[model samples]
Target: MKRIFLAGLLIFALNVNAQVQTPAASPHAELEQVVGLTEVKVDYSRPNMRGREIFGDLVPYGAIWRTGANATTKFMIDKPVMISGKELKPGTYSLYTVPGEDMWEVVFYTDDSNPLITEFEEEKVALRTMVEPMEMPMNMETFTIVIDDVMADSAVLNILWANTVVPVKFNVMTDAEVMKSIDLALAGPSAGDYYNAAVYYLNSGKDIEKAKMWMNKAMDMTEKPGFWQYRQQSLILAKAGDKKAAIEAAKKSLEGAKAYGNADYIKMNTDSLKEWGAM
Candidate 1:
């Protein structure tokens, strides 16, 4: 019984010793960014240079790369976007690239379940584009993917490693989205809807008269309007060339702001009142 107990205790000790934790050779990374109205996400692993040659020798010049180490890189977007002038539907995809001396072929494959890609199927490719590689001034140690040069309707997806940088340009349909929202909101419009639509029109340099009308309607529907609401009403009225009404609205906003102890709104209304020669 004593010998059997000793053997069981030895096995338990060995099992505990074998369960050792170690750092990954290539650490995983995830990045998410909002480009215009679209949500872009990337999941991959970053491998270091480790004093080894990267592009030509280690990764090879004319082979399909997973775009990262370990499992294949996953790319996801919430909205449809035009990638390199080609439309790509919203979905998760495996990102792969074929590296060359001057240009690189970037591909988005529909299949994302596979951790490692052993074969490349042409039919599974959703969108493929050739992007020119730029030589960086300094060397980069770890692989990195970034969404850069963001604008209201477009952004650039950049891949960087070693001394090479590849950029892919994509465009989002912001105007289409805004128009759709406007149409839907007008179908069964609420007070908040009217206010939001008015603000959008005011900021986008649309018809100031229409914005003023909508802002007035929004204020009329509310039993008691806030100081900020009165401030927007004043701006819209001023833009629509109703100086007298703008001054009255600003005065009301100034009174409300004073009661609420809001320093910012008070200053804004006071400034506007002075500009309109009401103060």
Candidate 2:
């Protein structure tokens, strides 16, 4: 039949031009959160050394480079996270990087759900540190992987390729263990991440009237709006003076922190509820 349909259309045009010339598949970078009900997922993979010349010969110093391909570079923690100081439960890890011209060796593979289950099993190490390489001389003709320094609690997990620079530190969960895991994740999930763990126990250093009773029971299981739990229960009801329910919860959290663009948390709740009678 017409030469078997021209040999199956020339083998499907050479398998779609060999998948459009292959190179271009790096993506699965992540950084999830939820420390109370424990749902931290930090899968990461970065493949960029474009202008080449990295580690002796394009990543060949001790060999074992799949660290940024199909798998390896994961860290899906869940509850308890206070590393380098103990308390490290709830797992799923496999993060490795051994690049060294100066310094870089950070492993932590607990191996699960397949990170090649310890590729060659370095005794399945659960922690192997040695970090420090933010060398600046700025050139970086390519290769970039980011996850910036976030801290309301803490975060930082970068690893830019050539010109090197590695950082990995994310310690979150502790305010009596996120208020006993947000009272066990508010009795049992509906999920807004435990209403952000009741607005992170009513904004850190908690205990403002038990964080306004867990921000009014996480605003009755969240419908959302509770902007900073009405600005920390209107500064704990204007620090007990109760300026009429703290100016009505600081005008409902300054209209929801100006509809959430959060201009510096709406000027700190309109300068602490309209400047407290300015005198």
Candidate 3:
């Protein structure tokens, strides 16, 4: 009985020692956002301050950092984006930055085989830009990165750590996408399609005759055309320098707008008619 008890005690001690857990110093993090139609993703590791001086002592100023604690920080973009007015192609890149008192050098390297950036070859750099660092109001114990101030075509990529914030502005091309969609929509033209094409042509100053043809088709296809469509027709005619037809279309738009009880469109048509000498 004594021998068995001693063996059981030895086994429990060995098990407890083997089960010791030491968590990672830096934890992995991921951020993904959509700016316009482009998808931007970032993968990195976050390291805490742990009550030590971070900037000048641990991270070091004026030196390249992996932008994370462990492994190379991966930045993946689905489509082309403009950063600080410079264009970057769509792909995965390794993000690195050189910390500074005022300005920081941001780098996107195509090759990121080295996590420490110790073998950073200039040839592997895809894009490089400089940005100013902003002082944070409060100390940030853990490193953080976020996509902020998102607009229709632009957003800011922010990095916050140790009371410092660095922001990089990026823009996505929306016009090209809108134009492509317009082309596809106009391929099999419906009444609404014709109206949209006419509006685009009229506004862009491209072929007034085509705009007139499309407006005519839109009106003919709709058994009861809306006042807005007639409004577009009037605008198209006016741009085509057909004052007489523009005035006639404006009158039709005014009548239709009144019938729909749309005060705004009624005012629009009334103003347009007065301008065209049809009131």
CA-lDDT, candidates in order: 0.91, 0.65, 0.88
Candidate 3: tens digits of C-alpha lDDT, residues 1-279: 999999999999999889667888999999999888889999999999899898888989988898888787888999999987889999999999988888998999998674565556878888999999999899999999999999879999998998999998889887788788899777767888888899999999999999999999989989988778888999999988998999888888889888879999899989988888877
Error of 3 at 217 (Å): 22
RMSD of each: 14.1, 17.1, 16.6
Model 3 regions lying over 4 Å from their true place: 1-20, 189-279
Ten residues in sequence with the least summed lDDT for candidate 3: 111-120
In angstroms, how far off is 255's CA in candidate 1? 59
Give the runs in model 1 whose Cα sits over 4 Å from its true position: 1-9, 17-19, 190-279
Tens digits of lDDT, candidate 2, 1-279: 999999999999988788545555665667676543446676765566666687669777555544566666677676666555545566877766776666677676676554453245766676666667777576555445555665645566676766667786656675666677789877775435544554566557555565555555656666765677677667765654568777787888888888878898788877876688632
Highest lDDT: give the candidate number: 1
1-279, model 1: which lDDT tens digit per residue?
999999999999999889689999999999998877889999999999988889998988878899998888999999999987899999999999989998899999998985466457889999999999999998899999998999989989999999999998899988799889889777778899889999999999999989998999999989999999999999999999999999999999999999999999999999999999987
Where does model 2 exceed 4 Å of error?
1-39, 50-133, 136-156, 166-171, 178-279
Give per-candidate clash totals: 0, 0, 0
* Candidate 3 global CA lDDT score: 0.88
- Residue 91 alpha-carbon offset, candidate 3, angstroms: 0.6
lDDT of 1 at 101: 95
